[model samples]
Target chain A: MITTELFVKMTIDRWNGSIANVNKHLNALTDEQLQKEIAPGKNRGTYLLGHLIAVHDDMLKLLDMREKLYPELSEPFIQYADKVVEPTPTASDLRKMWEKQNGWLQEKFAKMKPEEWFEKHTAVSEEDFMKEPYRNKLNIIITRTSHLQYHSGQIVLLN
Target chain B: MITTELFVKMTIDRWNGSIANVNKHLNALTDEQLQKEIAPGKNRGTYLLGHLIAVHDDMLKLLDMREKLYPELSEPFIQYADKVVEPTPTASDLRKMWEKQNGWLQEKFAKMKPEEWFEKHTAVSEEDFMKEPYRNKLNIIITRTSHLQYHSGQIVLLN
Candidate 1:
């Protein structure tokens, strides 16, 4: 039987691979290149980094894990065009924030108990919330990874 | 430090949870309810089951473990209108099929070697190909649980 501990570890490792790849790609670019409209009306490089950091923040809340340190996310989410875009953060700042985010999330997953994998929970708001599925902690881990990879494709396309 | 063996175990466990939930849900429904349209358009419970089974068949190929017990599928992909809209599956067959797929996938993952995890491979075509950053073995493992759970939402919404 696959335990929650095993599942969390796999998730953390996969995220490690993904973040490493994205950060490597980001660090290769210059500031001007990061700002260039690779995909107009969508997002540039720096914006994508900020978005990733935002995603990790949400993952923490959803999974009931400890939140990571990110100083740039002070505003509420705004749907800009088809994307819920965040403003650009400096490349260096984004990298530091993401590293911190990933670190804290990893630590949380590492300590989680295997027995709680299937416990179901609902969010406080549903009236105005986008109704999807009722999920547990395990679901949260997998969903965030899927979401990241899907957006990573968008970033790759933007490049 | 996460080895391939550990990832494989995690992948298999996720499949177990998914299959259990889906099958449990499916077994509680009536055959009449199975045929009834859970939503607008032409979608019904049967369509959702068929789609999931079809995708499992596709996912089997994506994992590239071994040949399926059934013959190669020649039918078109199980798709839906509007993407998000769909009907639910019956509770019984959903569980049965869930167990069947999970068992098979786990066995395959266990037999695979650590070195083979990062191997490069090709698919029938670019459109059909499953590769890194999108569709790959690593992804198939990580996303399998979430993918099933996401569709389970579609199944629930159909109710």
Candidate 2:
């Protein structure tokens, strides 16, 4: 059985590692390259970048233990949904925002208590904490990082 | 362009919410309920949980920025490839591992740094850091969580 300390270390290592990579990828893009859409139906590089920024801002609510910023945004970003996937922040704007938000996250991490890693809170009204305390914090790391990667992949395929 | 901050936050929130829901769903299960295989031709709860844990453990290399563990495990779950779509960790073991790993993760968040979030490392010699910084981290979360949720949904169906 892996110890909780080992798991937590792994989770953060992976989560932060990816965050750094996204910046690296963005820095490599020329403005013109950023502006071009890879395919007819796909989001442009700028759009993807914007979308990611929007995603992080929205998600911060959960970290704050507040309600979701946009409860209306739902699954399947289908064109027909007419759903606002949060306001699309521009790339330049996104970069600044990305840096800022990650800054907050860093502070949050540094201040965390070891016991809090296992501290379980129900994000949904339907959740029962008594029966779910075993669920750990890495759960958040895995979910968030994976979600980013999935969309990033979509962006890559489009390019 | 979406800022990295907002993108990361949104991803984080969505995952937290989903996991909260998943915990609720899992807590609702009874022993008898867990035993019944939703897809008789494939893995049921016993196998699914184990599969998830095993896959997750493997993904830890990327999360922790270490070399891959269990390199001998193969590209997919080859041992059970004939009976299963992929090789998976056993369900009981996986759950135990998940609980332990997740517990550790809570502490990880506390130590996370905004600047560190953007720290980039190459996963493999040939892997392009410029293009795929987020690939390893994102892929780990997306694949494992989706795998769990898909099966958890199946587990729910059994009831």
DockQ of each: 0.06, 0.05
DockQ of 2: 0.05
lDDT, residue A5, candidate 2: 44
Candidate 1 docking class: incorrect
Best by lDDT: 1
Q: For each candidate, give its TM-score against the true structure.
A: 0.47, 0.45
Tens digit of lDDT per residue, candidate 2, span B99-137?
775555545533554334444423544346445444434
Q: State how far residue A151 of model 2 sits from its true place (Å).
A: 1.9
Return the lDDT, model 2, position B8. 39
The C-alpha stretches of model 2 lying farther than 4 A from their native spots are: A65-88, A125-127, A134-136, A157-159, B1-159
List pairs with backbone clashes in candidate 1.
B23-B95, B25-B91, B26-B90, B26-B91, B26-B92, B27-B91, B27-B92
Provide C-alpha RMSD values for all models, in order.
12.8, 13.9
